[model samples]
Target: MTTDSKRKGIRLPRPLAIFVWAYMVWNLLPVVAAMAFSFNATRSRSQWQGFSTQWWSGTPLSLFDNEEYTAALKHSLELAAMTTVISTVLGTLLALVVTRIRGVAKRPVNFILMIPIVTPELILAVGLYLSLTFITVWPFSVVELGTPAQVVGQVTYTVGFVVVIIRGRIAVLGDGLEAAARDLGAGPIAALVLVLFRLLMPAVLVGAMISFAFSIDNFVITQYLSSDSSTVSIPMYLYTNARGGNTTPALNALATVLVVTTLLAVALASLLYRWATRRESVASDVTGTVALSA
Candidate 1:
């Protein structure tokens, strides 16, 4: 224990600590194995011959050079970008509406919005696929089984998560700032953009990060909605070739790329969140000091 922890008498239970470590190891072992074998000199995933960067670079079968792997990665990124933008905007608006609305209807509306999150991915995918295939109505008729469909499917599920996150932030923030902004002669839209939205920026970034992460790793929806080879994503590519007899360490390298991409995005989001919150704190402190002086 550290000095602070010791002083506070905060000793972690021995068995619980061991169990947590063990659980982490168990969950991470396969991912670690995959990443390690991606650098193997040979093609065998089970047996690591030696350390080499062949799968990551140099050859045609390498992650970046390989057409299939590159295409999949690109598609995954495109989907993630689209889904994140759309879901964040829509979810933020929905959360704002949900939080502001009063009375008995609010509970039902909130529950309705949460339906997509609670629905199973496979079922959701199947429903979207069937609807897009069979329903020839205006909007559904215009949409097809490709990137557009993938975006729609991803956004549907991802919006719920964004709503949940933004709503939690809204709950903590309350309506005081917005009310004050109104009292200061700011219009409703101005109050939203200048006061409330500034405070909610951290939550928006978090929602975008979650949406991107979910979209990038999404398999069932992407798979069901794919029209052809061009629409295949990284997750789809990995599923197709991971157990193949002719598969190489290149597959592992691709998986590593996906993992690294997600980690980088998460790191970036965390930094942004910290920056935003720090600004909010500083602004609040300044306002408090000014009020006290007055």
Candidate 2:
């Protein structure tokens, strides 16, 4: 049977499908409602006062026009970008090194790397807060509780995710490609850059996107490390203003910006991943064909 026909034949029960849809609606309904209200002409978050873009752009209280909200959004994007780059690079290197370690050291090194993944975010934040405050060494002293500390805390939290994603890709790929590159007279670093890194591009892209998403959504670490208004992120801003009596749909507009940006980053990364994987598959098939011909 055709794959589509087979899938239809094995379709889930009506009750299961209903439950799945219900669960999705249960979770997404509120989010959809909130987003819908972002365009409300009035300040009421609950009562829809007709659609308007004033919250987004027109007035002084709008998302872009308001200095405080604009600053927070800008800071959030900056933090996410910095954290994504730093975490992806560091995590990719750590994953490669950890994957190659021999006998006794491998297990311990891997366990250490995974500690941040399993640790609670609050705990990590608190630890970072203490470390940045008390540690008086050159590096620690230089890192005050602000953007620098926020970036460090976020990188510490996000690097684990990158390591996990890249290591899984590395495991699937194995060392054959790198070995082949070396056999072709490429140096170690050359083989790694040209062969392994090229193959790992999809995973790296995914890791960076995930890091960006997490950093944007992260509240506890960012809050703990924030020095003042300058370090306020979207999540922190949302938390502070979400329940205020004077709050407007502008808050929701800010939230929509965060959600849209994250979704765009993920969607773009997914597209790049698909394209990279397709190219890798084509290259592998062509290489195999040439080898067989030889």
Kindly provide the TM-score of model 1 when superposed on the true structure, using C-alpha atoms.
0.91
lDDT of 2: 0.92
TM-score for each model: 0.91, 0.92
lDDT (CA) per prediction: 0.92, 0.92
Instruction: Give the range of the ten consecutive residues with the poorest summed lDDT in model 2.
Output: 1-10
Task: Kindly give the number of clashing pairs for every candidate.
Answer: 0, 0
Q: Where does candidate 1 have its weakest 10-residue lDDT segment?
A: 1-10
Tens-place lDDT per residue, model 2, 1-294, is 333354477678999999999999999899889888899989999998798999999799998999999999999999999999999999999999998999999999989999889999999999999988999987788999999999999999999999999999999999998999999999999999999998899999999999998999899999999999999999999999999999889999999988888888889888878887987677866776678677
Residue 245 local lDDT, model 2? 97
Tens-place lDDT digits, model 1, residues 37-108? 999999899997989999998999898889999999999999999999999999999999998889999989
